[model samples]
Structure formats: structure tokens, C-alpha cells
Target: MSVQPTSAPTWHRLSPRMLAIHPIIELGRALPALVGVFFAGHAGGHGLLTSLAVAVAVVAVSITRWFTTRLRITDEQVQLRHGLLRRRTVATRRDRIRTVDVTAHLLHRVLGLSRVVVGTGTSDRKNESRIVLDGLTAVGAESLRRELLHRTPVAMTNQGSEPADELARLERSWIALAPFTLSGVVTGLLVWGFAWRVEGESGVDLLHSGPLRAVGHGLDAAPTALAVVVVGAAILVFVTVTSVIGYVLAFWNFRLVRHDGGAVQVTRGLLTTRATTIERRRLVGIELSRPLLLRAVGGARTLSIATGLRVGRGAEKGGEVLLPPAPVDRARAAAARVLNGATALTVDLVSHGLRARRRRYVRALSGGAVLVTAAGVGWQTGGSLWPVPVAVVLLATSVPLAADRAAALGHAHVDGALVTRSGSLIRRRVVLADHAVIGWTLHASLFQRRAGLSTLTATTAAGRQGYRVLDVETPVAIALADAVTPELLSQFRRRPAPAPRATMR
Candidate 1:
């Protein structure tokens, strides 16, 4: 008997607007090389020809890419086929979709187009397996996002009118808290790096640039204290301005919405807009962050500790962020709302006791003590008084830092969630749901054991994988683990030695 051939799968092409978008994107990506070429051409008197050739090449590649890319959605899976030299096909099950990100860069926005990224829980920094559709009309992208996430055929217009409850919205006043955040420092470093790159490429000495030379001379002519004050003030102003601009650009029109279809969506950004939708089922916990400077200014940020969402490194700007630097009270409120008003956010945490406090002090001061010893040695051998003052300053600061760390150490179990608070420089309170905890680990170093303390870690499949309750009393750690997961350790429980029989003599 002869078998009949099956019909070919329907493949949909990207938006025609991608023809315009891809060229711009490819050209921008090749800018550094274009810059180098421009400099070389200027010197060789072939500037016009070289630039034209490069632009033509970029456009050719862009057109080829647009022609090759296609995507399709079947009942069982979503498939994508793309690439010119190395033709490739990627597919993922409909149920495996964990996140749907809709992004529009400036050019995309201008052309009414968007890019859709579909992520499974399997992706990480090392290994990435994601399906990306580089170009789609804004309405098509939104409709696809809603269809994939909600598993329903929900056609949407360019501007969606789906009813969603607002969880949080960006406030203009929150910009004040931006200076207290590390964003300014990060922005300054990026700016410095870019300047360094430009100087290296152009063979220019930025430090000896005309304006810089004048500033350097002025500083040299001024008194030491005056120069210090002027430099400090200048740095402060730069940081403040950059921070404010960054805050506005990144979080403009930020809004957190909970859709009726059991998903939470976050929409933000100015020049490059992004909308990320995460299933409520994947949300296992929430994190409240208070860095030292941010804490001093009574500001904090909120992040989602959800499965499939990576929350580390640049997580503050990633899809996991729920709220940017805002008042601490507001942060807590957002955390609570995310947790569905779980008491873990507000419940008083159980202290780790005096032994734990001592451990904190010892750990914090060890570095200072070593520095002080080295300073003393330098004073004896090299007669350096500067080391002594530096060591003294460090030692003095360590005491208060140790105290603050001790104050921050605590954990509690409330409403079937384990709430853990730790750290000093970047204090974090992680409220993890009971179901999220797959296992428990108790660890003790030689010093920790000697001090009758152990670190209890709750392992999960969600963000960070493990959340630690640092330096709790040994018995408390064991009891806490047992309380959270009784069945896991029931067979391994230690039995008390049988009471000695009374002597009959």
C-alpha cells in the first residue's frame, strides 16, 4: 500500500517594515568598524567610497536576513526558521513558554514594529535556548503575546484595551532616590569607558584635552582643600544629573499590571520600550532590596523571585524588577501586593541570638584587624604614619558596620513562607513560599560550629536557587528545617540515648 504525503507547514514571514529596521540595526552594530574605516579613509582620501561600500554591504545583509526569517505557531509548538549562511530552526512546546517579552527600540517604535522574545525556564547566562521573532507589527506582537500566554485567541489593536488591575506605577518624585542608588556610579563608569574607547580609537589623549588641561592647571594652582572640595562638588553634580536622566529614561511611564488571565505584566522604558509578561504560577517569591546608601535615604527596590526569571547582576534593569528605587514603605507594599498580601513581608523576624551577633562582629572586624596589624608593621619597619590613620579609619567604621549587619540578620516563618533577611552593604529580604522550598541544607564552618551557629539554606527551583538564613543557632537551624519540611528529615532524626537503668546495689 502507498502512503499519502502530508501537507507542508504554514510559515509566516516577518513584517515588511523589518526591511527598514534590519538595515539600521545592522549599521548601528557595525558602527565601531565604520568609525575605524572612516578614520583610515580620511587619511587615505577614500572616505566617500569606503563609507558607501560599508553601507551597501549592511543593507544587503539586512535584506537577506529579512527574507530568510519566518515563524509559525502550531497547537503543540512554536517554530522559528532564520539565518543566511547557517540555516537554523528552533522550536519549543506551547506549555514550555515561561515569559513573553515585547520590545520596541526607537526605530521599531517609529515604524510601528516590535520584537517578541519567548523564553523557557531552561535558559541561563551559560546556556541559552530562546525563540525570537525579530519583527512584527505592534498589534500583531501584542496579540501573539496574549495568545501564547493566555492560550486564547485574543485579537488586540495597536493599543490593547485588556482590563488589568494596576499594581504599581512610576512616580515623578522617585527620581530623587536615583542619586542614592548605584545607577549613577554605573552610569559614570559606562561614560568613562566609552570616553576611553573613543580616545583609544582616535589616538587622542583625553586627559590632556584643552578643557581638561585647563581644569588640571586650575586644580594645581588651588589650595589642597579647595581643590578637593571643587572636585568632590563636580563629581556630586555629575552623578546627580546622570542619575536623574537615567532614572527618567529607564522608568518613564513604568506600570505594573495584573491581568485577569493569571499573569502580571511590567511595561517601562523611554527610548527603548519593553513589556514583559510573567505567569502568576511561576512567581514563587519576592525580594525587597535596601542598599546602604539607598537605605540611608529611606529608599528601596522590589524584585520578583520567580521561576524562569533571572535575578542577578543587572537584575535591577531586567524583567524581574517590580519597582525601582522608591520609599522603603512603598517597596514593602509592592512586595506584599505581589505575594498576595502575605504576612511574611510585615511579620517580625526571629533573631539569630547573641552568638550570631558575635559571629557577625568577628567576621566584619577580621579584615580591619589584619589591616591594622599590617599598618603597625609598616610603622615599625618603614616609619609610615599614613598607614596608621587609614587603618584607624577602617577599624572605626567596621564596628558600626558589624552592628548594622547583626541588626539585619534574622529569619521567620509566616503564612507558609520563609522570610530571610541578611547582608549590610546590600540588605535583602527574600520571602519564599513554602511550596517553592524543595530541600534544606545546614552548613557550619569550624568557627560557626565552635560558636554553636549554622547557616540554614532553603533550596528551590526559583531565583538564586538557594536563599540563606545566616548564622542561626545550631538547634534553631535544625528545628527550623524540620518545621519547614518534616518528612524530609524524619528518617534521619537522632534518637536520644536510652536513660541509664537505676543501679540495684
Candidate 2:
């Protein structure tokens, strides 16, 4: 809704243009049901009328959103009253507002309208602390975004002294890294799900169809290695193409800006554009991560460790992403710029030493040994030599994996931040501010104790809650805890016993 400042707060309705956009959105959501009705009606030769009736009913329900929804912004709170059958009144104190997001889907953009989502920084999974108002004019949305986010914190930290507003923008060359991202896998799963739904609704076994059966027969007739190679190559090509397309569609004109009012803004997306503003005071740290595939190509991605945003399974949730899969150096530079320095990300991390390296090998080899033993048992019973060779190959592969895992393990404290890096499959280098550490935990398993190693975890309310420095020397772990939170750890620390008096000797 387009809210204007008045002498006193008053309820406002959503833009009239929403009447056009909501029905289309609702029809899209009802597509599965509509398709089911169409198939059933077609069998009875009444498809057209039945489908039309369902679509009309969905439109009618969608149109009611405009009539029933009302929003109001007062001096102390923002209120949204929505729903028809079951009324809901959501309110949030103005002081608790941590973020202001303005978004416009394809339909809304065509009508020059946007959606405003005000977040209160609550960690509730249900998102009950969020207030959403859709169907505001483009200008009105920008005005509201400024109005909500202009109130600077009482104690502002220095984000940067740079006078320029723009921080970074999408580069065309960076699109090459898109193919290395997992977007293709997500797209493949979504497509598979839709096809599965269609098969169930149509009562057809797609895998047993004539074309698929012929392809399966061909694959079976070919040599196993050749068939595997051919299928893997095809899947790789398909995934790469889809990933590139998805990247472009989502981040065509991406831009990041540091506003003068102590906030940073990210604006991106092609079909559904979004503008997200996060106050600088809420940003606790930044995370730089690289999936195995992307790391192999020297690419990385980054996310802002902010209080209001939740880090979900996806790469970019609530606009937490600072950069998408790009060159590792570029990612680091962007992260450094955002944090107003390059010290933490560039500092040398302390190695966990040979014991940690040996532990990684032991863990990796143990896992591989289990597979080898299982394969041996299967060979003894089924008299199949194929399993033995596969297991042997996996066991051999674990050697390099163990080495990589060892290489990825490191941690350091630099520039008022705790920097830690770990994992080989998806290596993450997190630079968490020292002030953000609320507590410390030290743990060691029997094997770790024997090796004089402990895992030190820094507990914080931001990001993932706890960041671990794995398999370091026990003494070093305790020292790190004391460094981060001296008072908190002093009480729990184990003090050394005094030496026996020399007089006794």
C-alpha cells in the first residue's frame, strides 16, 4: 500500500493495479489443481467448462486481497490487517525495524507497483515479525523504504570513510562461474518434481514409455564404462546450460550500494526485482564460501552476517549474499571492501599441525575401509568382482580427499575478528567480529584427547550460532577462548598445579 504522512495515522488500501496482478499470481499457484481438473474433465468430455469454473473461482479469491488488506504506519508501530475468513492484525514496533525490502515481481513491475516487507529481526521460523504490504507504486515504495530506514542507530559504527555510494555491480565476465554453482541441481529437482506430479495426475509411467524404454535398451547394450561416460557428459552439459541461464535471470543488473544513512542496499533480479536495505549496525560479520566445483575453478561466493537476515539453504536468502559465484579474489576483495578493510581475510591463519593432518587421514581412511569391507563381503556371497574394483577406486580417492581436508583446516584471530576456515567439499572462511562472541566451548573426543587436540567453538547469536576451529592443540584452543572472551572463560579454565616445594627434596 502507498502510505503518505498525515496529521495522524489512517488506514490505506493497496494500489488498485493489484487487482490485475494478484489474479495472475493466484492462477499460477492453482495450476496443479487446474491441471488435475483438466485431465479428469477431458476423460468425461467436459474439460473446458470445468477448468474455466476453477480459474474464475481462484480469481475471485485473489481479488479479495485488495479489498480486505489494509496497512498503517504510526509514530511507534507499523500495522498490517489482512485476511478475510480469519482476520489477522500484525504489528511491529518502529524501533525494532532492522530491514526494509522493496520487491516487484514481473506482473507488478508491468503495472509499476512493488511490495514492501518490514522485518523486525526476530529469529522466529514462522516469520511472524515481518509485515508485508504489496501493490505500492514504484515511487511510493522507494519513499517508504527511505522513510523506514532513515532512522540511524544511536551509536553508529564506522562502516567506511569512503564518500562514494556504489560499492560493486555485476560484471559480465563473472557469468562464467555460474555454471559451477548448484543452481542447476535445484532446477533439475524442480523439473523432476513437476514431471512426477504430472505422471501421477495423468496415471502414466513416464520411465516405461516407448522412447525411454528404447533409450534404456540402448544404454544396456553399450559397454558399462562407455554408457556411464555418455550419460554423465549429457547431464553435465544440461546442468551447465541451465545454471548459466538461471544466473543471468536472477542477477542481470545486480548492484550494491552503501547509503549515507548507515545502511547498505542490494538490488538485483530480472523478472522479479528486489531492493533490500540492511542497517550497518546489525551487520556482525561476513562469510566467504566455495563449493568444491566452484573452488576447483578458483571461484567463491559471499554472504553478509547480519542480524535481521536468516541464512537459509539457498545461496541468497533475504538478500544476505554479498556476491554470487565469482573469482575467489573478487569475492575476497568485495568482502574486504564491505568490512572496510582487508586484514582479516588476508591474514595468515594458524595451522593445526601434524596431529590434525594425521587425524583427517585416519577419519577418511576409516570411512573408505568400511566401504571396502562391505564390498568384500558382497563379493564373497554374490561372486561379483565389479563391487571390489569400485570399492578399491573409492579407497584410493580418499587419500587425496584427506590431504585436501587437512589443507583446508586453519584458524586465526586478527583485526578484532575470529577467522576460521574448514571443510573440503564446501570450504568456508568466516570472519566473525570479536565483539560478536557471546561465549566459548571446548570439546575433545577420546581420540582427540590422545592426540592432544580440541575443537574450540565460538558461540554467537548471529549467523550459524557457533563457528568452530577444529582439531587444534588443546592449549591453543584454551588460549583462543581466553583471547575472545577472557572473563567468561577464566572461571571455567583448568589451572596448573603448583610445583612441589624444593625444601621437601
Top model number, TM-score: 1
- Give a tens-digit lDDT track for model 1, residues 93-183: 8798888889898999998888888877632333265788878777778887888888766433224567898999999899889888868
Local lDDT at 56 for model 1: 91
lDDT of 1: 0.83
Worst 10 residues of 2 by lDDT: 153-162
Off by over 4 Å in 2: 5-9, 122-125, 152-164, 205-229, 490-505
On residues 1-505, what C-alpha lDDT tens digit does candidate 2 reach at each position?
4355443768988899999988998998888778878888998999878999999999999999999998887767888899999999998888888888888988888899998888776432356778888988887777767767775321232222323378888999989998889788788888899878877776667787889888888999999999999899988988999899889877778888888877888888989898888888777788899999999999999888876665565765446788878898988988888898758888889999999999999999998899999999998998788988998899999999999999999998888888999999999999998888888888999999999999989988666778899999998998887887788878876789999877853
Report lDDT (Cα) of residue 312, candidate 1: 67
lDDT of 2: 0.83
Local error of candidate 2 at 90, Å?
A: 1.8
TM-score for candidate 2, please give it.
0.90
Residue 106 in candidate 1 has what lDDT?
95
**Deviation in Å, model 1, residue 59 alpha carbon:** 4.4
**lDDT of the candidates, in the order given:** 0.83, 0.83
What is the Cα-based lDDT of residue 405 in candidate 1? 96
C-alpha RMSD of each candidate structure in angstroms? 4.8, 4.8
